[model samples]
Structure formats: C-alpha cells, structure tokens
Target: MSLSSKVRTLKELPLYLPRRFSAAQRQRNRRNAARPPAQGIVVGLLAQVCGRLVKAGEEALRIPERLPPSAQRVQEELKSRGYPHRVVETEETTRSAEEAARAVGCGVGQIVKSLVFRGRDSGRPILILASGANRVDVAKIGKLAGEPVEKPDAKFVREHTGFAIGGVPPVGHPERLQTYIDEDLMRYGEVWAAGGTPNHVFRLAPNELADMTGGKVAVTK
Candidate 1:
C-alpha cells in the first residue's frame, strides 16, 4: 500500500496519536532524509518516513483472512456494540505490552493491558484496563474496588472472559465484571486493546472504551 493509504487503514490512529509525539517523529524523519549517501540509508524512502506509528501498525499488523472461533466472537461483540475499529492480526503473537505496542506502531502507553483479578473474598472477577506503561498495584486496586483482589490464573481468565490472557479484549465477557480504566489511558485520544487472541488487537477512544466496559476512570496504581 502507498504510505498515506497504509496509514488510512489504521483508521483513527493517525489523527489520534498524541500530536507532540507525532511531530517529533516527523522532525526526525526530515533530518534523516537530508543525510548524504554515506549514511547508507536511502534518502527517497527515508524522506517519506513518518513515525513508527505511521509504519509499524500497518506493516507489522495483518488483517486475518479468516477469524478463529474466539476471534470471531469478539468481532461479533464489537460489531454489536458499534466499535468502529475492527480486529487486526499480526504475524507474531502480542503476548506482552511491548509486543502489542510495537506491533500496533503506537506508544507503549497507548496499549490497553487488560488484566483480571478476583476479589479475594467475593470470588468475583474484576477487570482493570491499565496503560501498558503503568503497572497496576494490586493493593491499590483492591482499595479502589472496595474489596481485596488477587490475580486469577489462566483457567479463571478463560472461564470468566471467554478468552485467554494476552488476547482478552476490554469487553465481551460472558458476565459483566466491575471494570476500571487507567487514568493514564484516558489521557490519550486513542488506545489499542486486545482482539481476543495474542496476535489480534483493535483501537478505540478511551472514553468509548470506558462506556463499552461500563468502566470507571482510576489511577490503576
């Protein structure tokens, strides 16, 4: 795809990436483009370069020809909820925050790292949509949740969310949990979340994410 079209495929990403962050990347690309042949990087292609945000998500990301069962279910849920961005897959699994961010070509902070913790006493699931850049402090989460919370295992995650860890989207759980969003994630205009598989992800506005999950904004430790 041409560069602009490649960017377009990411939908709202180009417009919603942090302005200061995008500007800095463009400046660097301009400087790199002016370097002489001795620099060994091709000036023509380099000149067209934007930020990693421009090239990364579309280049590294893939649109699966066929969706798996879990992926298909997540797709249906997103459609049912009117989420504009659809799932994009990757050649490699985005099992970690770093991997997802790099694959999506956005800041690590823009990735919604979905986490599941069970109430220590209630035996209920609690979902935390934290920024990839911040670690959710379990103790603080417990305080915010008004109950002590502890991490759930893979089995619990699948049973509760209807998907495996690393691939759980912010919504589509069989049961609605008490959900919370990281204030840090709310700082951004757009954010990416898991698409029901380690290799899948999708983007959405933070507020819309909150609504979809019926989540409250919080510091998320």
Candidate 2:
C-alpha cells in the first residue's frame, strides 16, 4: 500500500481493533487502546518535519536574478556602448585567473586578465589586457609605452580604474587609460573578462574587446 494509506490505517487502528473486556482482560484491553493516539502524534510530527525539509530545499534552489551594484555598472556600460553582452554574477569567487576559468568552464587562455601598471617616469596608469595563460613581460610593455612600467599598489589601481585589482574590467574606468592588448589574446575567438566584482564576469569576442577599449594589439608576453 502507499505510505499515506499506511499512515491512515495506523491512525485508525485504535478505533477499528476488536475490543475484549472480560473480568481478567479489562486492564490489558485498556492499556492496548491507549497506544494509537501516541502513534498518531508521532506520524503527524514526522509529516511536519518532512514538509519543512521540502520547503527548505526549494528555498535554497532560488537565486536572485538581480545583479550586484558593481556588476550593474559594467552591464550599464555595455548597454550604453550598444554591446549585447550581459554581466553574469555567481556564488563562486573568480578573483584569480584559475578560479575564473573554473567558474566559467573555459580554458585559462580564454580568460582576459586586466592588469594595471604605473609608468615609471610619467606616473600615469597603464592598462594591459593579457591572456590568463600568458605571463606579461614588463620590459616589452615598457618599450611599447616609451617608459618602464612598475607594479602599483591596491590604492593606485582603485584610483585609476575605479575598481579593485582582481575585478577590473577593460572599460568603465574613471578616465581613459593608455591601454594595450596582448597579441596572445587575439588568438581566442571569445574571451571572458571581469565584470567589476570578484564573482562577476562577461564574455565577448576578442575583436569586440579591442574595439571597446581601443587598445593597441601588441606582444605583451
């Protein structure tokens, strides 16, 4: 029989059972009659517990459709520029290139690493969009920029890019920065970039990235 039917039968057992009341059996019959109410109470409690667990599972599966504030800015920028890409936010952290690749289920080479550097002589910010699988050559970038470049602190990165180190995007900076695109990144048809937050990202064509940032394609690695 079905589980519900079984519970129903158990609940009605006290009422349906044959009753016997002889002089010697009277006390034993009374004790037997008292058990069904306790069993019914237990069944009711089990049903309530099962219902609450189902409710909790449903609630855990629901994720908010709205984007975070930082991600929203990136989305708005793409919209204003007439790009069709949408920012995707996830529960997993994509702060590192490896983590980002894992989160998006893409090869590391397909992830764009937005790196910011300080021009040694001019004290200006330089933006380099490199492939995640490639290591940038600072000397080569210095020659291309006409000055040696130095790694900047977290404060310098935030001041220039209007975002944090790990979550910087190619566009939406406070001001236009001298940008460079890694030639290695050009090999990928599509690439993923940070969307202004550690847990946010967006995908786009390599050519579209060059157009959006207006960065010169050069040998960065």
Clashes of each: 0, 0
Per-model TM-score on C-alpha atoms: 0.74, 0.69
Give me the candidate number with maximum TM-score.
1
Q: What is the Cα root-mean-square deviation between model 1 and the actual structure?
A: 10.5
Report lDDT per candidate. 0.62, 0.60
What is the per-residue lDDT of model 1 for residues 1-221, given as tens digits with 9 covering 90 to 100? 54346456756544322222444653443344322111110000000111433344344556666788777887899988776677766666777654544454444544556777888999898887765556667788889888988777778877987887667777778999788777876666556667778877666677888888888898876
**Which regions of candidate 1 deviate over 4 angstroms?**
1-58
Model 2: which ten-residue window has the lowest total lDDT?
Answer: 39-48
Runs in model 2 lying further than 4 Å from the true structure: 1-64
- Quote the lDDT for 139 in model 2: 89
Residue 205 of model 2 has an lDDT of: 74
lDDT of 2 by residue, 22-53 (tens): 43443442333222110000000000000111
Worst 10-residue lDDT window for candidate 1 reads 39-48
Q: Would you give me the overall lDDT of model 1?
A: 0.62
